[model samples]
Target: MKDREDILRQIEELQKKFLEILANNPGIVVVNSDQTGQVKETHSTRTLAPEGEKDVVVEIENASATTHAVTVLPTIYLDGRQHPKVYVHLGEATGALPKFKPVYSNPNLVIGASKSHIMNKEGTERFLKEVLFIQPMPKHMLLLIDSWPLFLNHSFIQQFVPQGHKVTILNIPKGGTSLSQPLDLNYNQQWKSVMRRLNDAILIHEIDYKIHVRDNLLRAISQVYWCFGAPRFCEFRRYGWYKGGYLDTHPAPFVTPPKYLFGEGSEGDCTCGEPGLILCPYCEKPHCFICFVANSHRCA
Candidate 1:
């Protein structure tokens, strides 16, 4: 028993060291958004969390049965409580959308694919195309995938063409899938060939890592891995985020550092109901939710 316990302790220490090494490696990051609008981050080697009490909020309003539509707004709590003030002007909600937010306190690092985002055959194909089309790729690229066809398809297997610094993908999946052609086989055979084509592509992975596909896969990739996986995602997601707006960029003002850091500064309420130092300073303003537009005139 004593010997076994010692061995277990040594193994634990070794695992920690391994994780540290992988986290520092330059590779890819994966980003995932589920029905709950919770964001998950993944990286090629490990996972990490956004540091703070921040909780991503997604609001849905005007929901009806027949008229179904979904809008996602990522946000964090103003105070320590569970109140997520982020608003989404969704039309209706019938089907379930698994929106996931990261637990910024203890985030997973960007590693391989998270199973949450991996969909059926068609979904996998669409995701692969998105990865291929992203322009101005980052220094290191990471892909989080689960489907065998999408992972091994010719479109992706063409070769590693590094337009930027680095590129990699985290292939995620459940244990008992009916995939005859495992992605690992294709990757092992073609990875070297692809690397040669890119000239500067770097691949990062740990052989013994057991990644959870359903829960942490998308979360790990989206929040952390996306940075390395798709550095140009800011340009790509905007196309989807701003479909309702003109000018190509998103019409909505993305949450900045100031917004997240400047929570309730005072004991009393500013127009938004949360206590903060920077009051709306406007009498007509109803709440702090719209204070961005309203208080900007009076305060700023």
Candidate 2:
């Protein structure tokens, strides 16, 4: 086994290499795409009620009867200028995948529900051709990714590298994903949180209409589209290099600083000046778009 000092040295070297790549490529477009699975509506937690009033428990009846999962592949660019793309995986039961809904034309959504919900070779190729390829980006682009088998496929590399789309697999040290992977460190949690809120909204709507939301592929598709199509969702793609200390601004080098490291004062109130432009589903607190972005849309 390696000694503690030796392991630390190796980690430092790995980070140094990563930073070197970033420093060398100033304007390179960094792309990251990841898969997230969402199941049909789940049981809501039981809540307390006032005295003499019984607690009403909302449970998903026959929860296992109509099992469904949505595999979402969200592609984000480092620069906030480019619009993000999100693809939804539909299982085999949903025959003949539908074209993306008209409203979400810019983000370019695709549907594939055959054999598996997870991204496959075909889906990957389609995404490259339809989403990434068509983007009006620079000649040289870097795709930051984890060690996913599909991403490392020989055919995939052969098809893209010659065209100047380079893929770099992050060498994630043990327990280092939060520090190395952009999607893990910055995007996925925010995406999932938005997904949860969307799911909850759908469930509540179903309850109001006395409709069963389970096994409803259309509902699932709607939720996926709404969440992914949201402008805030696309804006959530922050680069990990800046957050992980692999890249830094002026007056800082080598040393990684804590969040809000510079003596920047606390964030001021939302620019909108409207405290309750939108009400949070969980907390029932009103928040403007600025507040939502600053707080990651979580209940305070």
Candidate 3:
């Protein structure tokens, strides 16, 4: 539990202070960061096995669903690494609309696409070395990892973790990850539910959207993932940390997805004369769900 870790940390601090006083030594700086990431087997696989937790709040995990799992990724291999021209060429279509934008597109995220799509041993190490540590982190690091077989190799993970740092990795007990890890406590389910809502929107509206297409799939997932950035879900995330023992005090009560997003707020009529329940935040335009989704209505 975070409370327990805090006590233990305080004890260590006290010991260090006492020893410093006796030896006349100075104090040291500690760099702290917490985050999460996911290791997916395929593009459309909802099968989620969380990779690790960087800290208590930031989550690096996948949303559950398989609607786009078959977007095949071809493997490229070379010995002594061929020149850049050795790579297959693509026209502007590859860079066209519907890019797979993540919640954060810059240094905050390090992404890799693989043929298998799973973060196997090599991929996990790359995530640690490249994506997870995109920037120089603090000297003292604590990582919360599930008891997945790949993470069992301390040396392999250490190979990617930066040098000159004290990293403490604690693996959740087997079968305990579902409860011990903050990311799983409710994060994954909420994420899946959001995607399901989008799926429902797509189906019920009978829109001719090609969301199952690879590019469209990426775009849709990005849109759904982006929804969590709203204040309601962002505040609800703290509850997961508290449940996972990362937070000592209970977080202030906040609105959840169902209560906020799913609840029937003030009823009104769409501009098309249809009865509407959802209002676009940007335009305050009341829109029937079908109009909002099918027409892709938004502020001009």
Candidate 4:
């Protein structure tokens, strides 16, 4: 594992490399956007430190270092002028980005899961079926992915978050607690460290964070779903976590929704299905609540 010095040095190197890139292209500009989506543009100037500068950079750097874990910070480079900017780091890799974005189009729904893995997959699929297919896509989406991105398959992410929506995936590494509430799952060994392993995978990838992958996940999902008029996409949180850092416990059996909303035009029954009901997508699957079973480690 790279030590703190190595990480800082690497960051300095990247800055120097960026400086060189800037030198070659005089028109280069660095744009910084705050959480409000307000844009601020700045020009780069080369000035070696004057004879006696406080050199406060070291102190600021030290204070910022504590905000580890990816998905929090977002470094954007919008060369000169561009509408769509690319993320310079993966979601969780940057610890400064806010936990959620400002825009929430649709009414937020919470689907809790008994198991983290089950929550991951099931939440994704149900979002695809009910939310994406049924309702209009939001202008913006803020997603929280627990642990690492392992449970997610890129292809599926591409299918959701269709155009018209800009989704951000925030990762909460293992050993982190939700800003909202304590998760129902106990951290004891009885659960066999499943959540721990999942969290570790996230931390490993975040060591030297890269934004290309996160941008791809966001843009890919946006293009297919938005540009192509495909169904709207769902953001995965490795489990069911809503915006504002709210942690959802697995829903009780009676309240949980079904796996497939419309299975080949046949019925996908939930506990609430009425006897002799139409047995159709509209009747049985009332909402997009993924049964926690789908995200279980056993199924994964």
TM-score of each: 0.27, 0.61, 0.55, 0.22
Alpha-carbon lDDT, every model: 0.28, 0.49, 0.44, 0.27
Which has the greatest lDDT? Answer: 2
Tens-place lDDT per residue, model 4, 51-165, is 5874322111122322221111111112211112211122233323334752111122212122211233444455444443234433443333343354235456556656654
The TM-score of candidate 3 is 0.55
For model 1, the superposed segments whose C-alpha errors exceed 4 Å read 1-62, 65-136, 145-166, 175-287, 293-300
Span of ten consecutive residues with least summed lDDT in model 2: 254-263
| Over 4 Å off, model 4 | 1-123, 132-134, 148-155, 178-300
Q: How many times do residue backbones clash in model 3?
A: 12
RMSD of 1: 20.0
Best prediction by TM-score: 2
Question: Which order, best to worst by lDDT?
Answer: 2, 3, 1, 4
Q: How well is each residue in 1-300 modelled by candidate 1, as lDDT tens digits?
A: 876565445444533543444477735332222112222211222222245745433222221322222222221111111111211222212222334643212121211122233333433333333333244444553332333454645455334444444544433333311121121222112222221211111111112221222222223223222121122223333332123111233423432212222223322454556433322222322222223321232321
Clashes per candidate (backbone, < 3 Å): 67, 1, 12, 29
Residue-level lDDT of model 3, residues 1-300, one tens digit each, is: 886666556544533443344244223221111222321222223323336633223232344443234211111111101011110111122332235553223222233444433345544655566544434454644455566777667777776766676555556555555555565676556655654555554444444554544445444443333334344454466666567555567767776553444445524778888776455533545676556544544343
Model 2 regions lying over 4 Å from their true place: 1-14, 46-54, 63-67, 94-107, 160-176, 204-236, 239-241, 247-300
